[model samples]
Target: MRAAERELMARLPEGALMQRAAAGLAAACAELMGRVYGRRVVLLVGSGDNGGDALYAGARLARRGAGVTAVLLSPERTHPGGLAALRRAGGRALATRQKEDAAAVERAIRSADLVVDGIVGIGGKGGLRPDAAPLAELAEASRAAVVAVDLPSGVEADTGEVRGAAIRADLTVTFGTHKPGLLIDPAREYAGSVRLVDIGLSLPDEAEAEALQHADVAALLPVPGAESDKYRRGVVGIAAGSSRYPGAAVLAVAGALRGGAGAVRYVGPAGDAVIARFPETLVSDQGPKRAGRVQAWVVGPGAGDDAQSVAEVLAQDVPVLVDADGLRLADRDLVRARKAPTLMTPHAGEAAALLGVSRGSVEAARLHSVRELAERYGATVLLKGSTTLVASPGGGPVRVNATGTSWLATAGSGDVLSGLAGSLLAAGLSALDAGSVAAYLHGLAGRFAADGAPMGAHDVSESIRSAWRDVMS
Candidate 1:
């Protein structure tokens, strides 16, 4: 973002960039207000460019007959140009450093219709300083709608980590492009709804993180040609489930059926149960070696203590997806030794166990955890939770998925996801594409199945076709 801003600033006038940002910010504020006139807007001004943005934006609102007040945290260090502009445009400034101004500042914020959080910019890190923390709390507690400039104050611009107090904005109006923090959590949870205001900065093609849209997923989905047969389309083999947990294999097969694979072959103790549920499956009691030719294999859904099955599947030349019990039972060395693509799906708890860290630590630093695991295991890692992330072994743009709902936190959901991802892998998608695409579809399916209510793993699997259609349409 800095590079892009710098490049655009060099060709423009000294204050041109700030003016453009202020114009957009003011417009968004006005739209949010519905009627700008007679509205009370309070700006939490600091001694930085972010404060300058709020000051200039406040000046615009003042010109439109709205009552604007700038509460300056650093009285002497406030932006001279912005302060002068606000004062000239009929907006008032209150220096909060003085004890007498504290009551006035509180009153202004509490009674205001809108609060603009410009306390800290993207450059500012490690959360809000002690002096600025109170204002954030007040803004959050107030009934006024809050808007953040560039990003919510106190969030790590690149990493999405919030060490301490951070402003939870109702809307975040960012210039140039979307920052990594806005797309990821725990920072994402703070940035309610994001509005991208293009400042026309020429940015590189590469990005730190990426969120795939419908078009991207649609383009990646496999479609059969006129001459394509069931065998030519690709077959996905399932080595999951035992007598104790037959539903795991059933759910896995259910997900695989809708993953664009031509056929599904099952090899486990739950063959009878799998056949009973999904009669289309090619059931075999013989292990993965003799399970017949397959483009990909999905292992470890409910196979308890079945380390040998995990090993046998890993030894195969085909692409493999490991989930549930397979993640724990699969040998790390054997996974690293695989010549074909390997995809490991794990929730926070599974990830923590593998990384030897607390679940809270993994949840807090999801982006870092997923990348570390991918590099360590020499495979693509899909870290699933509120925001599912897919990272490659060599490192590139990590894919972030947020299409799911809280209802997706049900039993056997991971098994379905594993099967779907493996099927995508069998259908000729790379491990990276397979995992990310599967997550996207799975999340969308979850939303459809849930539909503002409770749902089961089977409901999500059944809704996959609807999700695929929605994406394709």
Candidate 2:
């Protein structure tokens, strides 16, 4: 972003970039307000260009007959040109150093219809400063709508880590291109909705992270040809469930049947339950070695103390997907030694276990945690949560699944995802493609099954075909 800004600045006159940003911001704020005239707008000014953008935008609002007040956090370090422009346009400025000024700032926040948060930019780290923390709290408690310039204050732009108090904007108007923090959460939760304003800066085709849309997922889904049969399409092996939890085996097989794979092979102690629920399953209790030929293997869903099966599947040359108990039972050396692709699907808790960190640590810094897990495991890792992320060991762009609802937190959801992803792998997609596409379909299916109501894991599994058809349509 810095490089793109520098290149654009070199070709244009001084202050041109800031002017463009302020104009876009002012327009967005106007649209939000419905009518800017006679509305109360408060600008939270900082010490950098972010403050400059807010002040200039405040000037635009003031010119349109709106009451504008600039609360400068750093009086001596505020933008000179921006402050001059705001003053010229009849916008009032107040400093937070004195108790009286602080009280006035609070009063302004309480009565304002709109508050523009420009206290910190993408470059600012840690959290809101002690002087500015109270203002952030005030804005949050206010009934007024908060609009963030560039990004919300105190968010780590690259990592999306909010270590302390951060502004929760109702809307964030970003400049140039989208930052990684805006797409990934914990910071994404703070940025309510994002609007990107183009500033004519050229960027690279490949980014550090990317979110897949409907068109992208449609192109990656596997479709069978006229001459294709069950073997040609792909057969996926499932080694899940135990006597204690036979339902896991049934759910895994259910998901694999709906996936692109032509056939599903189930090998576990729950063969009777698997055949009863999914009569089409090729059942065998002799284990994965004699479960018939399969293009890929999915291991460890509900296999209580089933480390032997996980090890057996890892020995195979075909692509392997490890999930649930498999994530816990599989050996680190065995996973890293795989010649073919290995995909590990883990929630925050499982990822923390693998990384030897707390679940809170992994949840706080999801981007860092996922990437580190991929690099450490030497395989493709799919870290599932509010925003499911797929990362490969090659250090390319991580794929983020934007679809899904809070209802997906139900039981056996991860099993369905493992079967779907393993089936995709057997169908000739790469580890990255399989993990990302499965996550997309699973999330979409979860949304369809729930539809604002509660749904079981089997409901999500049954909705896969509908999700696939929706994508294909």
Candidate 3:
């Protein structure tokens, strides 16, 4: 982003980019207000260009007959030109350097209809400072809508880490492009809805992070050709479930059935249960080695105490997806030694176990944790949570899935994801593609199944077809 900004600034006249950014921000704010003529707008001014943007935007609102107030955090360092512009347009400014001024800022914030958080930009780190923390709290307490400039104050732009008090904006109007924090959670939760304003800056072809959309997933999904047959499509092997949890086997198979696989081969102790629920499954109790030929293998879901079977599947030449109990039992060295593609699906707790970190650490730094796991395991890692992330070894942008609901937190959902991704892998997609696409479909299915109500894992599995069709349509 800095590179793009520098290039654009070199070609344009001084202050031109700032003017464009302010104009775009003002327009978005106007739309949010419905009518800005008589609304009260407050600008939380800082010591940088972010404050300049807010100040100028406040000037625009003031000119349109809105009551505008600028609460300056650093009176000495505030943008001179922007402050001058706001003053010329009849916008009042108050400093936080004095105790009386601070009190007045709080009163102004509580009564305002709109509060623009320009206190900190993307460059600011470690949350709000002591002097500015109270204002952020006041903004949240206010009934007014909060709009952030560039990004919400105190959010780590590149990592999505919120260390301390951060501004919670009802809407964030960012300049140039979307920052990584706006897409991932922890910080994403604070940035309510995002509006990107183009400032004619050319971004790189590949971003550090990416979110998949319907069109992108639709294009990636496999479609059968005229000559395609069950064998031509691909067969996926399932080494999952035990007597204690045969439901995992059923749910996994359910997801595999809708994952574009030609057929599913089931192996392990739950053969009778598998055949009972899904008669079409080619069942065998002989284990992964004896389960007929398969293009890919999905091991682990509910394979309790089946370390030998997990090891056997890892030795196969085809792509393998490891999940649930398999993640715990599989050998790290054996996983790293595999020449074939390996995709590990682990929730925060499992991920923490794999990395020797606390679950809290994994949840707090999801982006970092997923990438580290991928590199250490020398395979693709799908870290599942609020914002599911798929990271591949050798480093590139991690694919983020933003379609899921809290309802997906139900049991057996991860098993379904495992089978679905494994099926995609068998059908000729790369490990990364299979994992990301499966997460996308799984999240959508969860939403469809739940729809603001309680939904079971079976419902999510059954809704996969509908989710797929929704994407295709």
Candidate 4:
């Protein structure tokens, strides 16, 4: 589902999709309430199909002997059929006829047992209006477990932006496919844990995906065969690091060693330093072309704007990771015509340069920007930040690194990510697989290394083995 958004809505009727959504939502409520016998189910209803879905689901719960109530925000514009259905099923429907203030709504919301927020969905624009703002505040402050209908209300379904205020849900029962807002952050902050309900609405072919699951990540990893030796697995060449920045190369190689590889080959002025730190790495003083056969190349971590060296590495016939300076030196045609896979690991800034857009633009719409980069360069792209997203040009599951700790953002952290991913590429995993798995494993390692304390890049690299051990068990 990676096609354009407008095209996705073309296949289904809006009304039919709503009914299917309500049905799925009712089923989830039944499961959550266990037997649904005399349990209080409160729906903070709004003036949209999202609220309609909630009211209809409340009707179903009332039918099953549960006590359900819908607190409508817009009484005049409530879903007509939904009101009738709730009454028939022995559910009570109430409107905020008192004060139309945020404080009054917050009080009602705080008193709920299982609160259903039908405030906003994919069609919403901006933040919560004052009338509905207090309800969101109450949901956050209360002991009630909020189960949002469609998506957490007040979240931008297209972009992941949370404007003024948003409902923070313990569980969001989203209709149809996952919206981009639920997957991307800022808004992702409000959505506690996302759960999907398959209604019949056809998600657009261009629907962006996020966070690859562990089983998928495991499949992406390169496991060695019995006959494979160090030479046969694959050799990865690194042209990162300079006299000015020697530590970046060290961290990259440290990560590379953990990436399932036959061998790692290091070439550049940092040879002495890299060898001194990682004695296992095969260091060479020769040029990239003369550095011998390699299955993959990891370039640009600390390599400055040496145009000739960057071009030489790009000219090679292996999978390449263009990062830092490598992104600046890249020729569009050269990238497209490359003999093997290409993976670009750029933070928001680098992606902005490649797309000729502002850094804020990339950060604001990371999912879209990463996919655009992949399609533009015909490569896999990993956009690193709070939610590390890996998007492939081939339209696969986009992986988000949820395992990362805040401490993982230290200097040279990204350098470590590159080396680890490059090693996986050398070991024969596809670009998407290698990049996503690296992000996952790297985050896990970071958490292990840091525990609760702040850490340097070396500590994160050192934690790789322990994290791997835990995974094996």
Candidate 5:
């Protein structure tokens, strides 16, 4: 953003970019408040461009007859021009660093109709400083609607890690482009609904991360042609389930049936169970290699200690998806040696086991953990969580899945995801695309199945067609 800002600023007039941003911010604030006039607005100003954005925006609100107050964290270092504009527009300013101004600061924030968090910008790292941490708490406790400038204060812009105190905003008005922190969670949870204010900054085609929207997913979804047959469409092989966990095989096949794959071939001890649940699935008592001609293989949902099965599936030349028990049993050396694309899906616990780190660490730093896992495994990784992330082994832009709901956290959910993703792999999408697209569809299915309530893994699988149709429409 700094580079793009520098490039744009060199061509445009001084302060024009800030003005463009402030105008949009003020407009959004006005819309949120419904009426700007007589509304009390508080700006948590710091010593940076973010503070400048809030101050300038506050000036706009003050001009429209709203009561605007600036609580400057660094009064001496505040943006001079912005302060002057606010003061000129009949807005009041209070310095929080002063011992005597604490009461006034608290009172103003508590009574305000809106609180604009400009205490820190995207450049600010770690967390809020001692002087400003209290403001974040106050904003949280207040009845006012909180809006963050660019992003919530103290979030890591490059990664979504929130080390310490960060403001929880009802809205975040960002300029130029959406920061990576704004999309990934922990920080995404801080930044509520985001409103991007374009300042005409020409950014590069490549980005650190990307999110696939409805149109993007729709474009990638496979549609059958008139001449296309079942074999041509693609067949996915499932090497999962054991004597004790036959439901895993059943659920995996359930997801695969709705996952755009023409045929699903099952090879496991749970053949009768799978056949009972899904008769269309070609059942095989033998191993993966003998499971007929499969375009791709899904291994390790409930193969419980079946190292041979996992190894056999990994040896296949076709694309392979490793999940659940497979993630643990599959050899890293064998996975790295495979010529075909390998996609590994692991939750925080599974991922931690692979990286030899605490699950908490993986959950906290999802972006880093996913990337590191992909690099270490020499394969594509889908880190499943509240925010599912797909990282490619080659390292380009990691895809973040935004369609997730909390209700999706249920038993056998990963098994369903494994089948769905493997089906996509068979349909000829790249490992990265298949993982990301499956996550997107799965999340949407979870939302539809749950629909504000709890749902089983089977319910999620049943709703995949609904999600597919919704995305296509």
Candidate 6:
């Protein structure tokens, strides 16, 4: 998989790398243009290699008979060779030095058939500098296809977190491998579609990658044999909801029902509430030990802050998903001692609590936080939020779920997700697969249920079968 460290190589001569990048970038631009002979192209050039890449690509476009123009934001520090090449290929190179110049450049952007953004790259610290900011804004307002070289300017390369403003690109021609920022959120929102360009960099070992495609997810989904019965599929015991918040228990059970588990054995205080909502669920109030054998457990969705219930769930040897209230009550070692796998699904607030930090810290550096949780707990961690991420103890690619909507912030949504994931584990998927696949489907279901309108937690749970249909179909 591709990453930031692999993309930022200093071993080779800077000029050689730029040339290779420019070649791939030009090819991508050509593919976008289809017929470059008469197209008008604008190159937004800055002061670094990103700017150089745009200039070089512009030169190639101009050589192929396209009308190319390079707007220099920083004339004094522009790439000399790149500027020379564009000029030699009959492309107009101009420098802007005024506030109104941004608008004028925007007009030029509007007139262009395509725009190449080389304003910033991995090294940029803040949002767009004064001049480049307006230019990027204007490009956003324009109709031309915007292709970012390396990554969208102002986006973090190592993490998908966006600190300040950033340009939204239609396509990003990245080098070597993928950057973590390209796969994560906020930054991922600005990156429309990512295309990898091989520069022959020997990358180091990666800790994680991103979401599994359809075929990959299909491979990971549990499939029952003809001889299989509900018992063979494994049972999931749930400790969720209460009299005051019985809806949480019902929704959690709603999620677990479709989780492919043979049966759901609910062992919480609200057994009557669970039976009332989901009569199919096997309900018990006699604690986990008497709830019959289960392959996995789901704890903490509305389980209240009662330390007793959290302690009972953690005491089980089955694979456990510690979420919501359980994240607060359960000791980390109890989870560590589990013989079966452990999965932790914590939204920003819960994750912050687990790490003893502010919620803002977890949001700002989600990639780091997820990895840290997995490493610290020795369990798979699914950090839920804008860009839900799944991190594993044994490093692979961190899967980033892209299908969630703001509407999913509705109450009880997480309870449904936790139960769904718990069921996947009971069905025999690894903790990572169970959690990631559940996140993916849950997000899709949330979107399907909402359909741009508001929805309740029950709506989301009911839509799971539809989302399942989407995957199965």
Alpha-carbon runs more than 4 Å astray in model 6: 1-40, 60-67, 74-77, 96-114, 126-145, 197-207, 394-396
70-114 per-residue lDDT for model 4 (tens digits): 888888989988878888999876676555544445554666668
lDDT of each: 0.94, 0.93, 0.93, 0.81, 0.94, 0.86
Clash count list over all predictions: 0, 0, 0, 7, 0, 9
lDDT of 5 by residue, 1-473 (tens): 89999999999999999999999999999999999999999999999999999999999999999999999999999999999999999999999988798999999999999999999888888889988999999999999999999999989888999999889999999998888899887788989999999989999898999999999999998888999888888999999999989999999998888888899999999999999889899999878878899999999998899999999999989999999999999999999999999999999999999999999999889999999999998999999998899999879999999898999999999899999999988888999999999999999999999999999999999999999999999
Relative to the unseen true structure, what is the C-alpha lDDT of residue 216 in candidate 6, on a scale of 0 to 100? 66
Higher-lDDT candidate among 4 and 5?
Answer: 5
**Runs with alpha carbons beyond 4 Å of true place in candidate 5:** none
What are the models' TM-scores?
0.98, 0.97, 0.98, 0.82, 0.99, 0.86
For candidate 6, the 10 contiguous residues with the lowest summed lDDT are: 1-10
Between candidates 4 and 6, the TM-score winner: 6
The alpha-carbon lDDT assigned to residue 313 of candidate 3 equals: 98
Find the 10 residues in a row with the least total lDDT in model 1. Answer: 155-164
Top candidate on TM-score is 5
What TM-score does model 6 achieve against the real structure? 0.86
Q: Which stretches of candidate 4 lie over 4 Å from their true place?
A: 1-42, 56-69, 84-106, 110-114, 125-134, 141-145, 158-165, 175-177, 197-207, 394-399, 466-473
Cα lDDT tens digits, model 6, 292-340, are 8888999988888767777877787778998888888888887777777
True-structure RMSD, every candidate: 1.2, 1.4, 1.1, 4.5, 0.9, 3.7
Model 3 per-residue lDDT tens digits across residues 189-277: 99998999998999889888988899999999999999999878999999999989998988898889889999999988888888998
Query: Model 2, stretches more than 4 Å misplaced?
Result: none
lDDT of 3 at 184: 82
Worst 10 residues of 5 by lDDT: 252-261
lDDT of 4 at 423: 91
lDDT, model 6, position 177: 77
